[model samples]
Target: MWLFLSALVLLAAARSLDWQAWLADKSRQHLCFGAAIALVPLWMLQAGIRDGLEVHFLGLTTLALMLGWRLSQLMALLSLLLVTWFGIEPWHEFGANLLLGGILPISASYFVFLLSYSYLYRHLFVYIFVAGFFNAALTMAVKTLAFAGYVTWSGQYPWQVVVDDYLSILPLLLFPEALLNGMAITLLVVFRPQWVRTFYDRDYLINK
Candidate 1:
Protein backbone atom coordinates (compact mmCIF):
# COMPACT_ATOMS: atom_id res chain seq x y z
CA MET A 1 0.00 0.00 0.00
CA TRP A 2 2.85 2.40 0.69
CA LEU A 3 4.42 1.61 -2.64
CA PHE A 4 1.09 2.00 -4.40
CA LEU A 5 0.34 5.35 -2.76
CA SER A 6 3.83 6.65 -3.43
CA ALA A 7 3.67 5.67 -7.09
CA LEU A 8 0.27 7.30 -7.46
CA VAL A 9 1.44 10.56 -5.93
CA LEU A 10 4.58 10.59 -8.05
CA LEU A 11 2.50 10.00 -11.14
CA ALA A 12 0.23 12.90 -10.34
CA ALA A 13 3.18 15.16 -9.54
CA ALA A 14 5.02 14.19 -12.72
CA ARG A 15 1.99 15.01 -14.80
CA SER A 16 1.68 18.43 -13.17
CA LEU A 17 5.25 19.52 -13.87
CA ASP A 18 5.97 21.97 -16.67
CA TRP A 19 9.25 20.57 -17.87
CA GLN A 20 9.32 22.48 -21.11
CA ALA A 21 8.61 25.79 -19.44
CA TRP A 22 11.17 25.13 -16.76
CA LEU A 23 13.85 24.08 -19.22
CA ALA A 24 13.28 26.99 -21.57
CA ASP A 25 14.24 29.53 -18.96
CA LYS A 26 18.00 29.60 -18.35
CA SER A 27 17.74 31.00 -14.85
CA ARG A 28 15.13 28.47 -13.77
CA GLN A 29 17.11 25.65 -15.32
CA HIS A 30 20.14 26.64 -13.24
CA LEU A 31 18.02 26.70 -10.11
CA CYS A 32 16.37 23.40 -10.95
CA PHE A 33 19.67 21.60 -11.40
CA GLY A 34 21.36 23.41 -8.53
CA ALA A 35 18.62 22.63 -6.02
CA ALA A 36 18.57 18.98 -7.02
CA ILE A 37 22.33 18.73 -6.54
CA ALA A 38 22.10 20.49 -3.19
CA LEU A 39 19.44 18.05 -2.00
CA VAL A 40 21.77 15.08 -2.47
CA PRO A 41 24.19 16.20 0.25
CA LEU A 42 21.45 17.56 2.47
CA TRP A 43 19.71 14.18 2.45
CA MET A 44 22.85 12.17 3.03
CA LEU A 45 23.41 13.42 6.56
CA GLN A 46 21.16 11.06 8.51
CA ALA A 47 20.91 9.48 11.92
CA GLY A 48 20.09 5.85 11.34
CA ILE A 49 17.73 3.89 13.56
CA ARG A 50 17.88 0.46 11.92
CA ASP A 51 18.79 -1.05 8.56
CA GLY A 52 15.97 0.73 6.74
CA LEU A 53 14.91 3.57 8.98
CA GLU A 54 16.70 6.81 9.66
CA VAL A 55 16.05 10.31 10.91
CA HIS A 56 17.30 13.13 8.73
CA PHE A 57 16.98 16.83 8.19
CA LEU A 58 14.78 17.73 5.26
CA GLY A 59 15.05 20.91 3.24
CA LEU A 60 11.84 20.10 1.42
CA THR A 61 9.85 22.94 2.92
CA THR A 62 12.46 25.47 1.93
CA LEU A 63 12.77 24.01 -1.56
CA ALA A 64 9.03 23.89 -2.06
CA LEU A 65 8.63 27.47 -0.95
CA MET A 66 11.50 28.67 -3.10
CA LEU A 67 11.09 26.61 -6.27
CA GLY A 68 7.41 25.75 -6.05
CA TRP A 69 6.12 22.22 -5.47
CA ARG A 70 6.60 20.90 -9.00
CA LEU A 71 10.30 21.62 -9.12
CA SER A 72 10.65 20.58 -5.50
CA GLN A 73 9.13 17.19 -6.33
CA LEU A 74 11.48 16.76 -9.22
CA MET A 75 14.44 17.71 -7.05
CA ALA A 76 13.27 15.22 -4.43
CA LEU A 77 13.05 12.40 -6.95
CA LEU A 78 16.50 13.36 -8.18
CA SER A 79 17.87 13.41 -4.66
CA LEU A 80 16.35 10.00 -3.98
CA LEU A 81 18.24 8.54 -6.91
CA LEU A 82 21.44 10.21 -5.75
CA VAL A 83 21.12 8.95 -2.17
CA THR A 84 20.36 5.42 -3.28
CA TRP A 85 23.42 5.50 -5.50
CA PHE A 86 25.61 6.32 -2.50
CA GLY A 87 23.86 3.66 -0.38
CA ILE A 88 22.56 6.18 2.10
CA GLU A 89 19.11 4.78 1.40
CA PRO A 90 18.15 1.37 0.07
CA TRP A 91 16.98 0.96 -3.49
CA HIS A 92 14.05 -1.24 -2.51
CA GLU A 93 12.69 1.44 -0.21
CA PHE A 94 13.03 4.34 -2.63
CA GLY A 95 9.30 4.69 -2.84
CA ALA A 96 9.07 5.09 0.93
CA ASN A 97 11.71 7.80 1.01
CA LEU A 98 10.17 9.57 -1.94
CA LEU A 99 6.81 9.72 -0.29
CA LEU A 100 7.51 10.16 3.38
CA GLY A 101 10.57 12.38 3.22
CA GLY A 102 9.95 14.19 -0.03
CA ILE A 103 6.33 14.49 -1.08
CA LEU A 104 4.97 14.65 2.43
CA PRO A 105 6.91 17.75 3.49
CA ILE A 106 6.46 19.50 0.16
CA SER A 107 2.72 18.90 0.21
CA ALA A 108 2.36 20.05 3.80
CA SER A 109 4.25 23.28 3.21
CA TYR A 110 2.40 23.99 -0.03
CA PHE A 111 -0.99 23.51 1.57
CA VAL A 112 -0.15 25.84 4.42
CA PHE A 113 1.17 28.44 1.99
CA LEU A 114 -1.98 28.15 -0.06
CA LEU A 115 -4.12 28.75 2.98
CA SER A 116 -2.06 31.79 3.91
CA TYR A 117 -2.33 33.03 0.36
CA SER A 118 -6.13 32.77 0.40
CA TYR A 119 -7.25 34.05 3.78
CA LEU A 120 -4.42 35.59 5.74
CA TYR A 121 -3.14 39.11 5.58
CA ARG A 122 -0.46 39.27 2.89
CA HIS A 123 2.26 40.44 5.22
CA LEU A 124 5.92 39.42 5.18
CA PHE A 125 5.62 38.19 8.75
CA VAL A 126 2.63 36.04 7.90
CA TYR A 127 4.53 34.39 5.08
CA ILE A 128 7.56 33.79 7.23
CA PHE A 129 5.78 32.77 10.43
CA VAL A 130 2.68 30.87 9.38
CA ALA A 131 3.83 29.51 6.08
CA GLY A 132 7.56 29.19 6.76
CA PHE A 133 8.31 28.54 10.42
CA PHE A 134 5.12 26.94 11.69
CA ASN A 135 4.46 24.91 8.57
CA ALA A 136 8.00 23.53 8.50
CA ALA A 137 7.60 22.42 12.10
CA LEU A 138 4.21 20.93 11.28
CA THR A 139 5.70 19.08 8.31
CA MET A 140 8.31 17.44 10.52
CA ALA A 141 5.68 16.65 13.12
CA VAL A 142 3.48 14.91 10.55
CA LYS A 143 6.44 13.06 9.07
CA THR A 144 7.40 11.82 12.54
CA LEU A 145 3.88 10.51 13.07
CA ALA A 146 3.94 8.83 9.70
CA PHE A 147 7.28 7.27 10.55
CA ALA A 148 5.71 5.82 13.68
CA GLY A 149 2.91 4.34 11.60
CA TYR A 150 5.37 2.96 9.07
CA VAL A 151 7.41 1.16 11.72
CA THR A 152 4.33 -0.24 13.41
CA TRP A 153 2.94 -1.48 10.12
CA SER A 154 6.24 -3.11 9.20
CA GLY A 155 6.60 -4.63 12.66
CA GLN A 156 10.12 -3.25 12.82
CA TYR A 157 9.88 -3.07 16.58
CA PRO A 158 7.33 -3.26 19.32
CA TRP A 159 4.97 -0.27 19.31
CA GLN A 160 5.95 0.63 22.80
CA VAL A 161 9.62 0.40 21.92
CA VAL A 162 9.32 2.60 18.86
CA VAL A 163 7.34 5.24 20.70
CA ASP A 164 9.39 5.15 23.86
CA ASP A 165 12.71 5.49 22.07
CA TYR A 166 11.92 7.18 18.77
CA LEU A 167 8.76 9.22 19.07
CA SER A 168 9.83 10.53 22.44
CA ILE A 169 12.52 12.64 20.80
CA LEU A 170 10.79 13.19 17.44
CA PRO A 171 9.36 16.56 18.35
CA LEU A 172 12.84 17.66 19.26
CA LEU A 173 13.55 17.74 15.53
CA LEU A 174 10.69 20.18 14.88
CA PHE A 175 12.32 23.37 16.13
CA PRO A 176 15.54 22.81 14.19
CA GLU A 177 13.62 22.06 11.03
CA ALA A 178 11.51 25.13 11.59
CA LEU A 179 14.53 27.30 12.28
CA LEU A 180 16.41 26.21 9.15
CA ASN A 181 13.47 26.70 6.83
CA GLY A 182 12.32 29.86 8.57
CA MET A 183 15.73 31.55 8.40
CA ALA A 184 16.33 30.43 4.82
CA ILE A 185 12.98 31.76 3.62
CA THR A 186 13.41 34.91 5.64
CA LEU A 187 16.73 35.61 3.93
CA LEU A 188 15.39 34.84 0.45
CA VAL A 189 12.35 37.04 0.82
CA VAL A 190 14.35 39.89 2.25
CA PHE A 191 17.35 39.94 -0.06
CA ARG A 192 16.39 37.90 -3.11
CA PRO A 193 12.64 37.92 -3.53
CA GLN A 194 13.01 37.26 -7.25
CA TRP A 195 14.64 33.89 -6.53
CA VAL A 196 11.78 32.61 -4.41
CA ARG A 197 9.08 31.64 -6.87
CA THR A 198 6.20 32.26 -4.45
CA PHE A 199 7.44 35.48 -2.88
CA TYR A 200 6.23 38.71 -4.39
CA ASP A 201 7.18 42.05 -2.96
CA ARG A 202 4.23 43.73 -4.63
CA ASP A 203 1.72 41.34 -3.12
CA TYR A 204 3.23 41.10 0.35
CA LEU A 205 5.22 44.27 0.82
CA ILE A 206 4.13 47.04 -1.52
CA ASN A 207 0.84 48.71 -0.64
CA LYS A 208 -1.70 48.70 -3.40
Candidate 2:
Protein backbone atom coordinates (compact mmCIF):
# COMPACT_ATOMS: atom_id res chain seq x y z
CA MET A 1 0.00 0.00 0.00
CA TRP A 2 1.05 3.59 -0.55
CA LEU A 3 0.52 4.31 3.11
CA PHE A 4 2.91 1.55 4.10
CA LEU A 5 5.49 2.83 1.67
CA SER A 6 5.17 6.33 3.02
CA ALA A 7 5.71 5.05 6.53
CA LEU A 8 8.76 3.12 5.38
CA VAL A 9 10.15 6.18 3.70
CA LEU A 10 9.71 8.28 6.79
CA LEU A 11 11.36 5.63 8.90
CA ALA A 12 14.26 5.14 6.50
CA ALA A 13 14.81 8.87 6.26
CA ALA A 14 14.76 9.20 10.01
CA ARG A 15 17.30 6.40 10.36
CA SER A 16 19.56 7.64 7.60
CA LEU A 17 19.69 11.08 9.15
CA ASP A 18 20.31 9.63 12.61
CA TRP A 19 17.32 11.70 13.65
CA GLN A 20 18.18 11.28 17.32
CA ALA A 21 21.40 13.18 16.87
CA TRP A 22 19.87 15.58 14.39
CA LEU A 23 17.20 16.53 16.87
CA ALA A 24 19.88 18.00 19.11
CA ASP A 25 21.66 20.02 16.50
CA LYS A 26 20.64 23.62 15.94
CA SER A 27 21.23 23.41 12.20
CA ARG A 28 19.32 20.19 11.87
CA GLN A 29 16.55 21.71 13.92
CA HIS A 30 16.34 24.46 11.33
CA LEU A 31 16.07 21.79 8.68
CA CYS A 32 13.19 20.27 10.63
CA PHE A 33 11.83 23.77 10.76
CA GLY A 34 11.86 23.98 7.00
CA ALA A 35 10.60 20.44 6.59
CA ALA A 36 7.75 21.28 8.88
CA ILE A 37 7.02 24.10 6.48
CA ALA A 38 7.06 21.61 3.60
CA LEU A 39 4.91 19.13 5.53
CA VAL A 40 1.84 21.35 5.33
CA PRO A 41 1.43 20.80 1.61
CA LEU A 42 2.31 17.12 1.74
CA TRP A 43 -0.10 16.50 4.60
CA MET A 44 -2.79 18.35 2.67
CA LEU A 45 -2.24 16.07 -0.31
CA GLN A 46 -2.42 12.95 1.87
CA ALA A 47 -5.40 14.05 3.95
CA GLY A 48 -7.22 15.79 1.13
CA ILE A 49 -8.81 12.64 -0.26
CA ARG A 50 -10.69 11.57 2.85
CA ASP A 51 -11.18 14.78 4.85
CA GLY A 52 -10.39 17.45 2.25
CA LEU A 53 -7.70 20.10 2.30
CA GLU A 54 -9.56 22.13 4.89
CA VAL A 55 -9.33 19.50 7.58
CA HIS A 56 -5.65 18.83 6.95
CA PHE A 57 -4.81 22.52 6.98
CA LEU A 58 -6.76 23.01 10.15
CA GLY A 59 -5.07 20.10 11.87
CA LEU A 60 -1.59 21.32 10.98
CA THR A 61 -2.53 24.86 11.95
CA THR A 62 -3.80 23.64 15.27
CA LEU A 63 -0.55 21.81 15.91
CA ALA A 64 1.41 24.92 15.07
CA LEU A 65 -0.73 27.02 17.38
CA MET A 66 0.11 24.69 20.20
CA LEU A 67 3.70 25.60 19.41
CA GLY A 68 3.27 29.40 19.79
CA TRP A 69 1.83 32.57 18.32
CA ARG A 70 4.63 33.35 15.91
CA LEU A 71 4.89 29.80 14.71
CA SER A 72 1.14 29.57 14.39
CA GLN A 73 1.12 32.56 12.07
CA LEU A 74 3.83 31.08 9.95
CA MET A 75 2.02 27.77 9.73
CA ALA A 76 -1.27 29.46 8.96
CA LEU A 77 0.28 31.12 5.93
CA LEU A 78 1.77 27.86 4.78
CA SER A 79 -1.56 26.09 5.30
CA LEU A 80 -3.39 28.69 3.28
CA LEU A 81 -0.96 28.42 0.41
CA LEU A 82 -1.01 24.64 0.49
CA VAL A 83 -4.77 24.46 0.55
CA THR A 84 -4.96 26.86 -2.33
CA TRP A 85 -2.52 24.82 -4.33
CA PHE A 86 -4.52 21.66 -3.76
CA GLY A 87 -7.78 23.32 -4.85
CA ILE A 88 -9.73 20.61 -3.12
CA GLU A 89 -12.46 22.83 -1.71
CA PRO A 90 -13.86 26.28 -1.76
CA TRP A 91 -12.07 28.88 0.32
CA HIS A 92 -14.99 29.22 2.72
CA GLU A 93 -15.18 25.51 3.36
CA PHE A 94 -11.46 25.45 3.81
CA GLY A 95 -11.69 28.20 6.42
CA ALA A 96 -14.47 26.43 8.28
CA ASN A 97 -12.63 23.12 8.29
CA LEU A 98 -9.50 24.83 9.45
CA LEU A 99 -11.37 26.41 12.34
CA LEU A 100 -13.04 23.17 13.37
CA GLY A 101 -10.00 20.92 13.13
CA GLY A 102 -7.54 23.44 14.48
CA ILE A 103 -9.55 24.66 17.46
CA LEU A 104 -11.02 21.34 18.60
CA PRO A 105 -7.88 19.18 18.66
CA ILE A 106 -5.55 21.85 20.03
CA SER A 107 -7.98 22.75 22.77
CA ALA A 108 -8.52 19.13 23.59
CA SER A 109 -4.81 18.39 23.63
CA TYR A 110 -4.07 21.48 25.72
CA PHE A 111 -6.63 20.78 28.41
CA VAL A 112 -5.67 17.15 28.54
CA PHE A 113 -2.02 18.01 28.80
CA LEU A 114 -2.73 20.54 31.55
CA LEU A 115 -4.43 17.93 33.66
CA SER A 116 -2.51 15.91 36.29
CA TYR A 117 0.75 14.51 34.98
CA SER A 118 -0.21 10.94 35.73
CA TYR A 119 -3.45 11.50 33.93
CA LEU A 120 -1.62 13.24 31.14
CA TYR A 121 0.49 10.14 30.66
CA ARG A 122 -2.00 7.42 31.39
CA HIS A 123 -5.02 9.21 30.03
CA LEU A 124 -3.20 9.86 26.81
CA PHE A 125 -4.26 6.34 26.13
CA VAL A 126 -7.75 7.51 26.92
CA TYR A 127 -7.26 10.64 24.88
CA ILE A 128 -6.29 8.80 21.73
CA PHE A 129 -8.99 6.23 22.38
CA VAL A 130 -11.55 8.98 22.67
CA ALA A 131 -10.12 10.76 19.66
CA GLY A 132 -10.64 7.66 17.58
CA PHE A 133 -14.15 7.21 18.90
CA PHE A 134 -15.00 10.84 18.27
CA ASN A 135 -13.50 10.78 14.81
CA ALA A 136 -15.58 7.76 13.91
CA ALA A 137 -18.69 9.26 15.44
CA LEU A 138 -18.28 12.53 13.62
CA THR A 139 -17.52 10.83 10.33
CA MET A 140 -20.60 8.68 10.67
CA ALA A 141 -22.70 11.66 11.55
CA VAL A 142 -21.57 13.55 8.47
CA LYS A 143 -22.06 10.57 6.21
CA THR A 144 -25.48 9.98 7.64
CA LEU A 145 -26.47 13.54 6.93
CA ALA A 146 -25.13 13.35 3.43
CA PHE A 147 -26.86 10.05 2.81
CA ALA A 148 -30.08 11.38 4.12
CA GLY A 149 -29.90 14.25 1.70
CA TYR A 150 -29.19 11.87 -1.14
CA VAL A 151 -32.11 9.61 -0.24
CA THR A 152 -34.40 12.56 0.18
CA TRP A 153 -33.54 13.96 -3.22
CA SER A 154 -33.13 10.72 -5.18
CA GLY A 155 -35.14 8.13 -3.19
CA GLN A 156 -32.30 5.66 -2.66
CA TYR A 157 -31.74 3.00 0.03
CA PRO A 158 -33.39 3.66 3.37
CA TRP A 159 -31.41 5.23 6.19
CA GLN A 160 -30.58 1.83 7.61
CA VAL A 161 -28.27 1.13 4.68
CA VAL A 162 -25.89 3.81 5.89
CA VAL A 163 -25.70 2.31 9.34
CA ASP A 164 -25.52 -1.26 8.06
CA ASP A 165 -22.82 -0.57 5.56
CA TYR A 166 -20.71 2.07 7.32
CA LEU A 167 -21.26 2.28 11.05
CA SER A 168 -20.80 -1.45 11.59
CA ILE A 169 -17.14 -1.44 10.76
CA LEU A 170 -16.24 1.78 12.63
CA PRO A 171 -15.27 0.17 15.91
CA LEU A 172 -12.77 -2.10 14.23
CA LEU A 173 -11.23 0.82 12.40
CA LEU A 174 -11.19 3.11 15.41
CA PHE A 175 -9.36 0.85 17.84
CA PRO A 176 -6.19 0.52 15.79
CA GLU A 177 -6.13 4.16 14.78
CA ALA A 178 -6.45 5.23 18.39
CA LEU A 179 -3.75 2.85 19.54
CA LEU A 180 -1.37 4.03 16.83
CA ASN A 181 -1.95 7.73 17.45
CA GLY A 182 -1.52 7.19 21.19
CA MET A 183 1.73 5.31 20.67
CA ALA A 184 3.08 7.95 18.35
CA ILE A 185 2.26 10.77 20.74
CA THR A 186 3.72 8.84 23.64
CA LEU A 187 7.00 8.20 21.85
CA LEU A 188 7.25 11.81 20.74
CA VAL A 189 6.63 13.13 24.21
CA VAL A 190 9.02 10.70 25.78
CA PHE A 191 11.88 11.08 23.31
CA ARG A 192 11.33 14.41 21.60
CA PRO A 193 9.36 16.56 23.97
CA GLN A 194 11.19 19.68 22.92
CA TRP A 195 9.84 19.36 19.38
CA VAL A 196 6.27 19.37 20.75
CA ARG A 197 6.31 23.10 21.56
CA THR A 198 3.49 23.11 24.11
CA PHE A 199 5.48 20.83 26.34
CA TYR A 200 6.89 23.56 28.52
CA ASP A 201 8.19 23.88 32.05
CA ARG A 202 5.38 21.77 33.43
CA ASP A 203 6.68 18.68 31.69
CA TYR A 204 9.81 19.04 33.79
CA LEU A 205 7.69 18.12 36.76
CA ILE A 206 7.92 14.51 35.73
CA ASN A 207 11.69 14.30 36.08
CA LYS A 208 12.02 16.66 39.02
Off by over 4 Å in 1: none
Tens digit of per-residue lDDT, candidate 2, span 150-192: 4434444455664455444545544443344445445655676
- Runs of candidate 2 exceeding 4 Å displacement: 1-42, 45-77, 116-173, 176-180, 200-208
lDDT of 2: 0.42
Worst 10 residues of 2 by lDDT: 48-57
Tens digits of lDDT, candidate 1, 117-192: 9999999999999889988898888887887887788787878977877788787889998998999999989888
Give the RMSD in angstroms, all C-alphas superposed, for model 1.
1.6
Q: Among all windows of ten consecutive residues in candidate 1, which has the lowest summed lDDT? A: 48-57
Tell me how many clashing residue pairs each candidate has. Answer: 0, 0
TM-score of each: 0.93, 0.44
Q: After superposition, how far is residue 99 of candidate 1 from its true place, in Å?
A: 1.2
**Top candidate (lDDT):** 1
